[model samples]
Target: MRSVGKQLDITIHRPEELSVPLRRAWHEAMDESPDYANPFLAPEFAAGIGRHRGGAQVAVLYEGREPVGFFPYERNSFGVGRAIGLGLSDCQALVHRPGVVWDMQELLRACGLSVLEFDHLVDEQKPFGRFVTGTFASPVVDLKDGAGAYADWLRSTYPGVAKTTLKKERRLGRDVGDVRFVFDERDPRMLHRLMEWKSAQYRRTGRMDRFSRPWIVDLVDHFFQVREEHFTGVLSVLYAGDRPVAAHFGPRSRTVFAAWFTTYDPELRYYSPGLMMHLHMAHAAGGHGVRLMDFGRGDKEYKDWLKTRELRVGEGFATRPHPVAAAHRLWRRPVRGLRNTVLAHPALREPADRLLKSVGTLRTSGRTGLERPAPRTR
Candidate 1:
C-alpha cells in the first residue's frame, strides 16, 4: 500500500485487492454509522461491480497503523471518477469511523481523480455533501412494525385505497388460487421472467430498459450470485397458485434492503401486483432482519403509499479545482437541472410523459414476437 499522506495515509487498491482483514475493518466502520449501513456501500457490492467494471477501486484511509475509512469509486482513464456503480448504486459515501474527518481535495488527489460524481450520496458525508448542487428526497420504510404493518399503515394513511387494494388481492387469490410470496426466490427461470416483464414495462413507460444493455444484464447476473453477509441479492416473487404475478430484484444488507427493480405481469395489472409485491416484501423483510427498505430517489405513487420517511441524498461533482472538473460540471448540470425542473412541475411533466409514451408506442410498434398480453383493466 502506497501512502498518500503523513498523518492520514491513504492507500488505493483494486476492489479484488481488498484483503479479508480490510473487509472486516470496512464492515466494522459501517456498523459504527447508521448512514453507512446501506448494502451499496459494502465491500461486497463494490467487489460485485468491480468484477463487471474494470475501473473499480477502493481507497483505504489510515490513521497511523489502523484503518479509519473506505472510499469506493470508478475512475476512468481521463481521471473522471464516479460513485461505484453510479447510475445503478442508490447510496454512495466514503464509509468512515465516527469523528474521523478528511479533506476531499486531498482524497481526490490521492486517488488520482480530478472529480468524483455521485447522485445518491448519503447526507452525513459533509465534505462531499457541500459540493452537491441539489439534494433530493429518498423515501424509505421503517420495518420496525413488520408483518401486519402494511395493512395497518395503509388503513391509517390511505383509507380510500386500503379497502380497494385488499379487496383486489382477495379477488385475485380466489380467481387464480391461493396467493403466496417468496421473500427470496431461487428459481433461475423466474429471474428470466422478471427481466422480460421489466423490459416490457420499461418500453411501455418510455424508460430505458437496462436489460437491453448486455453489461447491465451481466452485472445483475453477477450480483444474483452474491451471498455475502453484508450483501445478498434478493429476488422476491409474488405468485398466485402456479403463476408468477410480480417480482423484485434487489440487494439487501443486514439492516437495509435497497429496492432496485420491480415489475409486474401486465396481464395481472388489474390486481395491482406490483403494489402487492412491495407490501408483501416490506412486511416479510422485517422477519429477515431488515430494519429499513430504501425505495431510492424518485417520485412514485407506491413510494408515497409506503414511505415512512424521506432521507436527503445529494447529487453533484466533488472536485479539486481542475479544468476537467469544471468542464464536466458545466456539461452535466444543465441537463440534470432541466430534467429535475420538468419532473417537479406537473404542467411540464404531463406533456413530457405523453410525448415519451407516444415515442414508446412507435418504437414498440414494429417489434415482432413480443408477448401479447390481455387488455389491462382499471
Candidate 2:
C-alpha cells in the first residue's frame, strides 16, 4: 500500500475481495468515460478471472477515502504482470473517475509489479502512452438509434453486401428451416457446443486453442453463471429450426458489448452463418441498450464491411529498468512486427494465411495418423 501526496491511497487486494461499495464506485467511474465503459473493464470480469487464476488482483485507488479508480492485473512470482484476462480481454485501462490521476511508476511500485504488458490498451491512457511500442486500429460498430436504423444505414452504405446477406438469410431459412435467433441464451449445452466448435476452428486455423486450457475453460464456465447489471455473459445463438448453426459468447455491460468467442458449424459455412449471427446480435444488442460493439483488434474483410469506425489500441510493455524486461521485449517485438506486417498487406497476408492453413492441415493429419495407418502383419 502507498499514499500519493496524502490525497490518494492505493491498496492491492484479491479481485474477489472488492467490496460492493468499491464495485459500485468502479461502475460510476466507468460511466465517466466511454473508454472505460467496456464490460472487460468491469469488476465482474476481474472477479471472474480471479476465481480461475490465483494471481489475479485489483489495485484500488482512493481519493479522500472514496474509491476513484481500479486497476486489475495478474502478477507472477517474477514480478511480471499483465492486464487481467490479458489474452482474452479486448479493452484495457485503469478505470478512473474524470478528475482522478495517479503516478504510473508509483502505482506499479505499490502493486509490486516490475513489468506489465498490455496489447489492447485504450487510447485515452496518456499516463502509460510513453511506453507504447505500437498502435493498431481496433474496428467497431457504431449503432445509431437502434437495430432497424443501423440495418437501413448498412443497406444504404453497402447495398451489394447487404442485399446478398439478406438474400442468403432467406435462402438459409427456406432450405435449412425457420432461422431463429436468441439474443440471451441461458442453456449451458449451447455454451459447451460453442467451445467445441471454437476449439475445432482453432485447430483448423493453426491458432492456440484457448478452450483446451483448464483455467480458461473454468473461467468461461464461471462467467456463464454470472448475471449482473454491469456484467453478464451473453450467449447469442443462430438456430435453424431446432439445430444451432452459429453461436457467440461474450461479456456485456450496460452500453458496450465485447465480441469475444464466436463460431459456426462448418457445415453452415457456405451460408455465412457467422456474419448473420453478428448482424442479428448487433440488432438485438442495440434494442437492449448497448451502443457500441467492439469487434476487437484484427484485420478481416468482414470487420471492414461492418465497422462504422475504429478505436485506437496500444500494444507495449511498461517496465522498470531490468535485464528481464529488456530480454522479454527483444524477443517479443520482432514476432509482433512480422505478424502485423503480414496482416497489413494483402499480398503477404494471402500467402501467410495459406501457409498457416497448410500447416494446420498437416498438424491435424499427424495427430489423427489417418494418412499413414499401420497395416496388419499377415
Candidate 3:
C-alpha cells in the first residue's frame, strides 16, 4: 500500500501475503495500549483463523512508505463479503501505532468488505458511524501490583460478599478434601474435560454448544498450548479433596484475565464452587501482577455483584467495495431494525432466550458423527 499526503493508503491482502514490517508495526502499536491489548488481533491469531477458515484478509494501512495499522478479519461471502468470525471474540479493531489516526470508512471501503461486523470491539475505536448494540455487564477485577492488594481492595469494596465467599472456601475445605487451585493448567486432557463440562452445561441450559465446531475446538486446543506473555491460555481448576469441583478456561494478558469458559460439578453446587474459584482467581491474578478480569459480555446478577465498573462495546457492519455491498446493507436494514426492537423490550427477552435455547438444542443434537472423547481429569 502507498500513501498520499497525510491520509493512509490502504490495501487488502491475504493473510499469507502480509509483509513482515506491517505485522511487526501492528504488534508494537497494540502492545503500547492499556486497554485489553488482546493478542487475538495479532498475526498469530490471524494465521490460526486462516488455517481454520480460508479467505482471511489483512488490511494494511500505510502513510509515506511507513506501515501504520493492520486490520485482520475473515471474509465471508453470501453475495457479498463480511468480516470473518467476528461474533465470538472479545477484542476487535485495527492495530495502529499510538497517536496514529485514520478514517474507518475509508479503510473499510478500501478492503472490499460488504459488512464489518464486531461484537466485542473496544470502546475507543471511532470508525463505525453508528452504535449498534450493547452487551450485558462485563465484570472486571483489578489486579495491579499483586494479589494481596487486590484482596485488600476486595475486602474494602465487597466486605460481606468477600467474607461470605471466603467462609464458604473454609467450609468446603473442612467438609470436602483438601482445597487446591491450579492457575495455568497445561494438561490438554484437562482442557478436553473442561470442554465436555461446558458442553454439558450448554445442553442442560438448552444453549448452543460451541465446542461442537471443529475449528473452535481446534482453536481452543491450539491456544491452550500457546504460552506468550501477552496472550496465554489460562485454565484454573478448584479441587476439593481429590475431585475437581470447579474450573475456568480463558485467555490472559499480563494485566487482564478474560473469563471465557466456566463450569462446576453440580454435586458441589451448595459450596458455590464457581464463585469460590473466581475469588481464588482474583487473588491469583493480582499476585501475578495482572490488573483486570473481564467476565465477557453478558448480563448476569453475578457480574453486577462482582464488577466495580463496565465498558461499552458497539456493533455494526462495514460494506465491501463491490456493487452488491449497497444491496446487502439495504437487505440487512430490516433485520437490524427488528433486532433493535427486540432489545428495547424487557418482556420479549425471555421468549427470545427460549427461542435461542431451542435453536441451540436442535443444533447440538443434529450433529451426527464420531467425536473426540471427554477428558478424564479437569
Candidate 4:
C-alpha cells in the first residue's frame, strides 16, 4: 500500500483478491456516482474478466481503511495498462466516493503503468480529461418510463421513423414468420449463434473478428452462466417463427442496459432485423426497470434514428514518461485518427467501406480455400 496524501492509501490487488467488503464499497460508490454506475464497472464484471484474463487487477483506494475508490485495469508485461474490457466496455471511470481527491499521475505510477489508454471514458473524469485527444457522441435512449412510453413518444416525435420501422417489422413477419422477441434469453445455443453471426459480420466488413480471440470467446461463454443482482448476462433475440433472425448479447445492471454485441443473419438484412431487435429490447428492458440504454460510442445511422439524446465520451491516453508509452502512442494514434477521419466523412467513408468489403471478400475466400484445400492430388 502507498499513501497518496495524508488521508489516502492506495493498494493494488489481482481481480480475484478484491475482498467482499471492498466489493460492497465499490458497488456503493457506483450507486453514488451516475458516471460509474455502469455494470461494466461492477466488481462482478471485474471478477468475471479476471477469471479468464490473467493481467486483470484493481487498485483500491482507502481512507482510513474504508474503501473509497476502485480502479480496474489490465496491465501488460511492458507496464502498459488499459481500462478493463476496454474494447467492449462503453463506460470507464474510477468509482469513488463523492469528494475523494487524489493525484491521477501518482495513481498511474503506483499501478506501474507507463500509459493508460481509454476509448469510452466517462466525461466527469476531470482529472484525466486534459489528456483526452478527442471526444465522441455516445447516444442513448432515455427510457424514463421504459419502452412503452418511449414508443408513444417515438410515434409523436418521429412518426416517419416509427412508421417505417413498424412497416419493415411487419414485412419481416409476413416474409419470414411471425416476429417474436425474447428480451432476456437463457439458452446457450443462442449465445453461440450470436458469436458465429458476429464473427461472420466482422469478416464481411473487413474488421477484426473479436471472437477469434480465445479469451474473448471464453469470457462470453462464461458470462452466459453469470446471474447476479447487480449484473446479469442478457441475451436478447428476435425470432421469425422458430428461427432466430437477430440477436444481441450484453450485460446489464439493475438500471442501465448496455447495448453491446448485436448481429443478425445476413439473409434477414433486407428486412432491417437489427433495428427490430433494438426496439424490442428497449421496450422489454425498460419495462424491467432499466432507465437507460447506452448505445456506446460510434457513428451509425441506426443509432441516430433511435437515440433520445447523446452523451459525451472521450478517447485518449493518460501517460507517465516512458519510451514504451511514447512509442505505443506514436504507432497507434495515427491509425485511430485515420479511422475516425473516414468515419466522420461520408464522402470518404462510402468508398472506404466498399474497398473494405472487396478486401474482405478476397481475404475470406482465400482463407476458405486454404482451409478446404483441393481434392487429394493423384
Candidate 5:
C-alpha cells in the first residue's frame, strides 16, 4: 500500500484486524449519499461475512490520522477478490468517501485482486471507464415524502396495475382470512420460512439454491437477529389465514428498504401475492418514514410494473498485482465477450438462461447431496 503526499494513508487490514474507527468513518462517509443505502456496504455485515468466508482484505483510506473510507472484499482464488459475498448481496462496493480520488488499478493491485466482478455496483464508480460490462436497472419506489404521495404517483403512472394490486389485496383480506402485512418483523422463524420458500423456488426454477450454503444460511439468520438504529434485517410477510403466503427478507436503513430476497407460495401465484405484499410494504414503509423501496437488481416483470424509477448498477473486473493477471484477463476476455454478446440480444436471453440452468443441473447432479428437491405443495 502507498500513501499520497502527506494527506492520506492507505493500508490493507486482515479481516480480524478491521478497526471500529475505520468502520465508523466508512459509514459516516457513505451515509451522506441519498441514493446509496445498502447495508452490505456496512462494516458489521462485511465483517460477519469476512469471518465466515476468510481471506477478506479491508482497505482503509485515511485522511491524515483519521479514517475516511473502507473497502471490504474477499480474496477468493489465486489472489482474485470481489465485493464480499457478492452473489448473495443485493448491493455491492465499499462505504467510501463519495468523491474521493483513488486509482482503481492501484487499489486493486494493493488488495491483490484479479477479475473483481460486481453485479450490483453503484453507477457513479467510473473507475472502469469504458470497460463496464453492462448496466443493470434496479427498480425503486420513492417514499421520500410519504406512501400517500407514492400511491398517488403509482395511480398516475401505472393505474391499471396499481388498481389491480390494491383490489387483490382487498380480496385477499376478505377471502384469505385476516390478511396482514408486517414490516421489519423481528422473527427468526419467519426468516427461516422465507428461506425455505426461496430455496424451494430456486429448485423449481432449476436455479442454484443459495441458502444451501451453510455460511449464507447462518449469515441470514445472524442478520435477522441483529437490530440496530440504522442497520436491521427486515422480514415483511403477507399472512393469509395465519399462514405467510408471501415474504420478503431484506436490509433496511432509517429511510430506505432494500428489497433483497422475496418468495411466495406458487399456489397463491394467481392472486399475485408478491406484488400485493410489495404494495403493502410501500404503504407501510411510507408510514414508518422510509423514503425509498429499492427492488434490487434483476429484470423481472413485476419489478417493471411496480417501480416508478430505475437505478443503474455497473460491472467490471479488477486485476491483482501479478504477472499472471494479464494472462488471466486474456483468458477471461472470450467468456466476457460471449456474455456481453448474449446479453445484448433480446432473443438470446432465454437461451442463455437455459444454458445456465443446464450447467447448474450438471453441477448439481455431479455433486453429492446437492440434488434439487422435489416441488413441495403448501
Candidate 6:
C-alpha cells in the first residue's frame, strides 16, 4: 500500500480501470469543488485521454474507505509526467474534496513521477500554488435566463455591440439565405468541416495544426461520440442558408460550456461570423441550462468584450527532489519564460503577429491555395 501523510492511501490505475464506485466518488468530488467543475477535470475526460494516450494514469487518494481525490496525468519512461491532455486541455486540476490537501513530494512519489507539469491550473489549488511560475486571466461569461438576457448584458457591457451585431445579421441573411444557429448539431459531416476549418486556421496563423496529427484527429472524433450528461460534445454552427459559415466544437459539463475548437469559413470574414456565432451560442447555451461559458485563457480583444469576469489560472512544474526533475524544469522553464515575455509585451507581440501573417501568406499560397486574413476563433 502506498501511504501518504494525512492518513491517505494512494492507488494508481489506468483511467479505464477505475471502478464504478471510484468514478462515482470522482464525480462527487467534482460536485463538491467549484474549481473542479470544468469538464477537463472530470473522470470522463481522463478516461477519454487514457483511451488515446498509453501513458495516461489516474491516482485515486483514499482516506480509509472513502475516496477523496483524483489526479490525472501522463507519465513517460523517464519518470517525467504532465497533466493529461496538457496542450489541448484548457483546464488542469486535481479534483479533491474540500479541505483535503496532499503533500506534493509524497503525491509525486506515490504516482512514481519525479515531476508533474501543468498549465491552466485552477487558482484555488492551494497545495500547488507555491509551484506556480505564472498566472493568467481566463475569461468567462455568466449565463442566465436565456440569450436575450445575455444580449442585454452584452449591450450594456459593450456599448453599441448589439446594434452592430444585429445589423450584420440582417445583412448576412439578406446576402446569403435565412440565417440559422444550431446549438447541438449531430451531423458527422459538419464536425468534419469544423476540423478542416480549424486545420486551415492553424496553418494560416503559423500555429501548429493539431488536426494534422492522427491521434489528435482520433481524440476529437472520440470526444464527438461521447454523450454523457456530465460531459457532452457540443457542436454549434452558424449557417447562412444551407451553408455553414462558422462552427465550434467543445465539451460541456452540465453547467459549464467550454469554448474550444472554433473556426469560420474564410470567405465569410466580412460578416464577422466568428463573433456572431459566439453571441448566438451564448444565448442558446444559456437556454439549455448552461450557467457559465469559459473562454479559456487568452489575451484577445473579443474576450474582453464578451466576458463578464476573469478566472485566474496557473502554470508550473511540481517537482520532487530528483535529478530528472531538476533537468526537466531547467530545460522547459526558459522556453516558457521567453514565450510569455513575447506574449505579454504588445510592442513585441504586434511585430511577431505580423511576421507570422507574412509567413502564413507564403505558406497558404504554396499549400492550400487559399490566402486571406480572417478573424480568429476566440
TM-score attained by model 5: 0.85
lDDT tens string, model 6, 191-242?
A: 8889889888887787777877777777888889999877888999999999
Q: Who wins the lDDT comparison?
A: 6
The parts of candidate 1 lying over 4 Å away from their true place are: 1-6, 145-161, 367-378
| lDDT at position 93, candidate 2 | 92
Model 1 per-residue lDDT tens digits across residues 198-306: 8877777676767777667777777788898889999999999999999999999999999999999898898999888888888789878899999999889889988
Whole-model lDDT per candidate: 0.87, 0.85, 0.70, 0.85, 0.73, 0.87
Per-residue lDDT of model 2, residues 42-137, tens digit only? 999999889888899999998877888899999998788898989899999999999887888888888888788899999998889788989999
Q: Tens-digit lDDT track for model 5 on 1-378?
A: 477445556798875567666666766876888645666676766766776777777888777677776777877668766777777777776566666676777667666675566667878776655546677787888864444554575576458787777677667778777677777787667877888888867765667788777777877877786676567888899898888889998877777788888899888898898887777777787788788888877667778777889888876666545666677667766786787677667699788788767765655566545475432322
The sequence of per-residue lDDT tens digits that candidate 4 reaches over residues 226-335 is 78767889999999899999999998888898899999999879888898888888878878999889999888888998899999989998998899999988988898
Clashes of 3: 15
- Could you tell me the C-alpha RMSD of candidate 2 in Å? 4.7
Pick by TM-score: which candidate is best?
A: 6
The backbone clash count of each candidate, in order, is 0, 0, 15, 0, 1, 1
> What pairs collide in candidate 2?
none
Candidate 3: tens digits of C-alpha lDDT, residues 303-352 = 77778678776566655455576676677766866875676676886788
Off by over 4 Å in 6: 147-159, 367-378
The C-alpha local distance difference test score for the whole of candidate 2 amounts to 0.85
Ranking by lDDT: 6, 1, 2, 4, 5, 3
Clashing pairs for model 4 are none
Which 10-residue span in candidate 1 carries the lowest summed lDDT?
369-378
User: What TM-score does each of the candidates earn?
Assistant: 0.93, 0.93, 0.83, 0.93, 0.85, 0.94
lDDT of 5: 0.73
Instruction: After the best TM-score superposition of candidate 5, give how far the Cα of residue 185 lies from its true spot, in angstroms.
Output: 1.7
